[model samples]
Target: MVVTRSETQTGAQTGAVQNSSEGWKQQPPYRTTEGDEGFEKKWTAHCHCGRVRYWLSRDGPLASKFCHCVDCQALHGAPFQWAAIFHKEDLRFESGAEGLAFYHAPDKSTTHRLPCKVSCAYCHAPIMDEGRNMVLMFPGIIKFSDAEHKKLFDPQCHIFYSQRVVDIHDGKPKWSKLDGKSELMKEVEREGSNTILGEPKNENMQD
Candidate 1:
């Protein structure tokens, strides 16, 4: 709802005016004047090229999940994509929305192994995806709160990395193995249980 300007234009992604003006515009009956409750305040984000954009509400703690399905690997061009989850109402858009694209891999049948993919309309940068329950937003797209938010709500778990190209053996972060070998596996594989660490672990968690 606020705008500022400097001197001359710079790069396509850097100098371009952010579409925040439109994305954060107040809804009617929801007065632009301060102190509107229905008007939810949200964090806005966009691709470097000013193509893909997103908005996130300031409600709820930041959370994450690592997806290792093969399609996820191809989509992110890595072992997995670490996504931060918030509610859908928490999201908003600004520009280049028409160019948003999607892809479904061969492993998909009833539904795509990878359900969704969002990219920059101009630069073609993959922005986010609908993995399980929460939309997997690329942390790099977020522009609000900067370092503080990054430190608090980054990726916490890695999912399906075994089928991914990059191996998760660094031990730099916590890791979990998949299940379904037997009934004992199911019993031992309860959520939040860990034998190696002598505690409960959430094995093969979704969302």
Candidate 2:
């Protein structure tokens, strides 16, 4: 369900191209506020089961990064989590808000709390990490028309690299913990390079 710029050019164009002879109906933008005072480009996204749906106010995320923290790996069941940072206000859920589930980290409680992970209740698909100030939305769920549009959500850096189960050589800055607040890790050219140059080996790698 990719939405390209050309497809969203004009309302009349979108309405005309609504359905194909093959019975495939084009998905329109969740909402378009062209005449609004502070209108921004909107992007639509939904859960795997299509139960929960939402849209982003801006065309691009504020910040995007790969998180390699133990919590992220454990929750996502992946090597690392690619997250797109967005202000809470910019994200609007069009449906299934009540059908969404929350998982409070570390404690693993279901209580609605800030800095918690959100997912589709029925499909159990990871949605976003709701923080106090911002939300870290999973870019994988977002619809991109093309590679260029997808690149808008490309990760700027890697966080919690020290705890990563896998080494990423994308050349993005690797932070030992939080970006800016923690040590910036030196890059290793070799594939299995674990030890950081001139730094003590992290023997306490999380399993």
- Local distance difference test scores for all models: 0.46, 0.66
Error of 1 at 97 (Å): 4.0
User: Which runs in model 1 stand beyond 4 Å of their true positions?
Assistant: 1-37, 59-62, 106-114, 131-133, 167-207
Task: Give candidate 1's root-mean-square deviation (CA, Å).
Answer: 15.0
Best by lDDT: 2
Going through the candidates in order, what is the number of backbone clashes in each? 9, 0
Error of 2 at 174 (Å): 0.4
TM-score of 1: 0.55
Compared with the true structure, what per-residue lDDT tens digits does model 1 show for residues 1-207? 111111111001222232235441343211232443554655666777876665555543356756555555565676566677655445555532455554433322222223445565468787775433345577766775667756655556554433444444433333333223211111232455333421223333232
| Cα distance off (Å), candidate 2, residue 121 | 0.2
